[model samples]
Target: MPPLNSTNNTESENVYNCPPIKHVPFPRSTSYYLQSEITDEFLQFAFSFLAASFQFLHLYRTVWWLPDTHMHQTVNFHLIDKSVALFLLILLSRRFWYSICITCVDLMVTKKRLYRMRLVLRYVFFFVITILLGICCVDIYFKHNNRVVYMCYPIIVYVIIFHFNIEPFLRTVYEGDMIYINGSPLHCCSTNPSAIRTEIDSLKKDFNNRFKQVIFTTLFNAYYGSVIPCFFVQNFVFYDIWITTFHMAFVLVGGFTTSTMFCLPANYCDVMHRAALHLGGWTRIDHRVASPATPWSKTTVWPNGSVVKYSGDFYRSHGLTTTAIPSNSYDNKFYMFFQNPAHIYTILSLIQVVIIVTQLFVLYFATEWHQMLSLGFLVLCNYFTLFKMIRDFFLTQRIYESESNIYARNLSN
Candidate 1:
């Protein structure tokens, strides 16, 4: 009876004096500009322009499939040209179509329907492209006598492979951040922490698998590295070397984009890892045993039975960053890769630099104006690659050094 009386007294006193503790979550930055200071419209325009420019070069090359003679020009579209054109049209139309679909999903559709529609659209598009790809491959192979077909066959193959792999590639490189930004609730609203945690775990697995695929694809796809050189090897001189140079430049641009895509996912992972460390939840340890880094790691259990959530600074720090620490330290392959991104980067840069220098030297020795112009373009593109790679390399090294310092400090404690 005394205990009951004391409990009642305490409850009545507290009820009169205190209010319930309400969770006020940190407001997540909703600005797409968070990732790039540039506006989304600008980014979209840049992407559309690049896509059109590159595909237009491929289209221009396909024109060669038409018979060189004037008499043949009077006929309707040739089978090879028609097929390649249809494929290119399908390819080129995809980005705009995708943008429309995304806009519809965001503005006009319900969440449940949006998810189902995305799955349906993904599989349907893949099935359609696969059929078109096969047809194009057969048509192009049958017309192998055309040097344009020979040169462009490799390009077709590159497209097919990239198409099949693109979903996974994009999921890793950008979708996680997109999902995080989109799912974020207003500060006053509450979300299901468990649901967020589950989604993040799924994202981690998806990212790991997709990132591995990107690495494998980049390494195994020899034609990507060899495309520009093959023109020289075949000794196939074109009437307009400028066109040829542009065509090859298109391929170089594609390779550069692919290389850039590979880096994005890795950088995202590193950003999250750093965020975890900064929030004081994650610890650096030897790679034999590694735990998943999560925002909840920083959660502080308070005396009053409340938990402190991760801060806005943690989320902001992770956005729009470059370089990465491998998330799964236990993964020997990834551990080695992350341990020295600089070394791997240097090797890739030197190989590309050598290739560019060789081509430049050859172009220089040739007195043709087109060759000289090609030399300038090659230098410009290669220099961009060099700058990007070196910058990322140093950034990664800094991440590693900071991590090492953190671990050392902890050990000394």
Candidate 2:
């Protein structure tokens, strides 16, 4: 047939490489923030690689309800798979923990004039602490197979929530670029700052206006939405995460970790909203006094008052950066609260502790819903923890690595 011959000719030409047209995919318009640099994507990839490897050396000896029954329907005793999984668990968990400490240190240290030796020492301090944690977990005093149910059962539940339920919900819901909650992938799309800011802001607005519309979307179809029926009712997975991670079946691990993770988003929302209110002038006037400023930060000199904070440079450039763009002073001001990051962080963290305490009772009494709830909770907790880890990394870059062109130009002189 003519069609078959034509197709064959095209294939032959492509195979022979007679200058066939390349089928390179065009980048999306929204990906404007992703410049020619491969650096950011590589760093994110490193973050994800570490996350996936978190399971390494994950051994806990605990008392078991049943001496030899499997909680996850099946158990893989294969040495290779076991080893890989364990490594992944540990590495991913470690990255999450490190993200917190690193963020704080970077923010604090970068603000001051510093030497290379101190910066290098700070990095060494981080690794030394991590190694100590690893050593403690390896001892036999902690490893009691008698309580494996107490150990593996809850962990299994957590993994289910992440890999099976909570993560899938986020991926299906957040369009364009998402890498679940715990892991990063090869595509550099997810961390392009401008795209992320736009997408997340849009989602939050959508959430604020019409979260109930969750039912009509394809994520909540007749079949898969049944996997999480609570979405049909509340139209969100956030509640499910809250209800599940507080299980008594996992008082020590689930209770502590779940509450910690849950606070991350709630805490972020509170902090950002507080800063937004100040920038938007919601605290002063009844009407929204509009301004062309980002929600997270803004700086306004009193129209008549002197901004006596800096020297001649502040007055010279008409309040713009040496790059001739608007100065990021507002952004810097918002983060200045990092000396504390606001009271709501403490409040949410404390409330998270209370919820875990309540969960202890729920575990002892609520038997029927235990497995499902615990599993769902575990997923939510890990997802939140993963999210917090990413935020921690990004915030550090914003505060520390962002070029202070003012400082740089002066330094060169």
Candidate 3:
């Protein structure tokens, strides 16, 4: 009885002496449900091909299959146009649905009313814009009046401008200080150094797949919507050609410019690699024995007073880092093409310049007043797109130059 009593007392004492349980709040920044399910490379490619086919078919029909008589022009909705628009709406709405789901889940967990309200407002705004766009499409399709179509262009322009201009403000309000390393959460208490690297690689691959999808859709839409339409039309109105060309240029510019932003994952990899080296206490130093100024040679001092030659492989093996480091060589050919933001932007800017010059030359031959007006409008839109591309190029160039200078300075020191 005494032994049993003593054991009980010890157990009680241990329980009383134990540290109070700390209730660590769940991480608000980390999303539990926001992840891509389609990971297979071949599946991704197949899906992209399917989407491109659908877009091409829709654009081809819109351009080539116009009503044979003015009597049929009274019809407001076509089956093909409505179907294509619905598909595109669904495609774009995926992000919105994801956001709403996330917010609802977050509201249940965090009980934050302000954030929920903000998201609700954003949802309303999206629906309003979508409805407005749908109305514009209906008007343009039904009337077949070039004047009405030209007037509707301003509304489309306003929507695009509003969307792009308000994005930065919206991001600041919505995301706050959440640290996302390549579109994935970086947990504050995570001990595994390789976790972020793995996530980044996955994200990069996903982004590359998505980029291909966008490029295919844009190019197909542009070709079928603009150039192919002109060839098929009986009247061959220069105004129709110019309007479609404007839309094609808009789509191409927006798609390619957005793609250049994906290089951020590579930049993030470089940063993580450098941080790992710094944490491992490795410092670049000139190697007198090998060559007087061997920039790649590095050294580090152990805690036990041992001087060790630094090797990236050796440090990585100690679990300080992983193979997330960006290099010139890539296994995927698509990755290689997109690896350099500056080069991509440079090429894109040149393409934009060529498109603008070609349009201007075409404009000089316009004889009719409406044709001149349409051509002038197209030129203006092209100029705006060109200016945007140039701005993005300079920004990208500056970022790379700054990073290079920082790395060079680190090597020198």
RMSD per prediction, one decimal?
12.5, 22.7, 16.2
The TM-score of candidate 1 is 0.47
Model 1 RMSD in Å is 12.5
Ranking by lDDT: 1, 3, 2
Residues 297-371, candidate 1: write the lDDT tens digits.
Answer: 211111111122233112111211111222423332333444334455566667666766766666667664434
Q: What TM-score number comes out for model 2?
A: 0.24
Residue pair clashes in candidate 3 = none
Highest TM-score model number: 1
Candidate 2 runs further than 4 Å off: 1-344, 364-413
| Model 3 Cα lDDT, one tens digit per residue, 1-413 | 00111222343443343222121232223321222222222222233333333333323333223556444432223333443344344433433454454456555755567666666756666666567656755654564545334333333443543344433212211232336543433433222224433443544454444444445434433443333333323342223444455545644554343333322223432333233321222222334422222112211111211122334222111112122222212322222343335565577678778766776776687654444554565466457556655655665566556654654454344
Q: What overall lDDT goes with each candidate model?
A: 0.40, 0.31, 0.39
Alpha-carbon error at 182 in model 3, in Å?
Answer: 12
Off by over 4 Å in 3: 1-193, 220-340
Window of ten residues with lowest summed lDDT in model 1? 315-324
Q: Residues 1-413, candidate 2, lDDT per residue (tens digit)?
A: 00112222433432342211111232222222222113322332233332222111111111234667553322123322332234333432443444444445545675554435345644665566447534433431244324223222323533543443222221212222433222211122221223323433443443332222222121122111122122122222123344322322232333233323222233233333322221211111112332222222112211111122232122211111111112445433332332233343444445545544554555456544333344345345444544444444344334322323433443345
**Model 3 TM-score, all chains together:** 0.40
**Cα shift from native, residue 151, model 3 (Å):** 25
Decreasing TM-score order of the candidates: 1, 3, 2
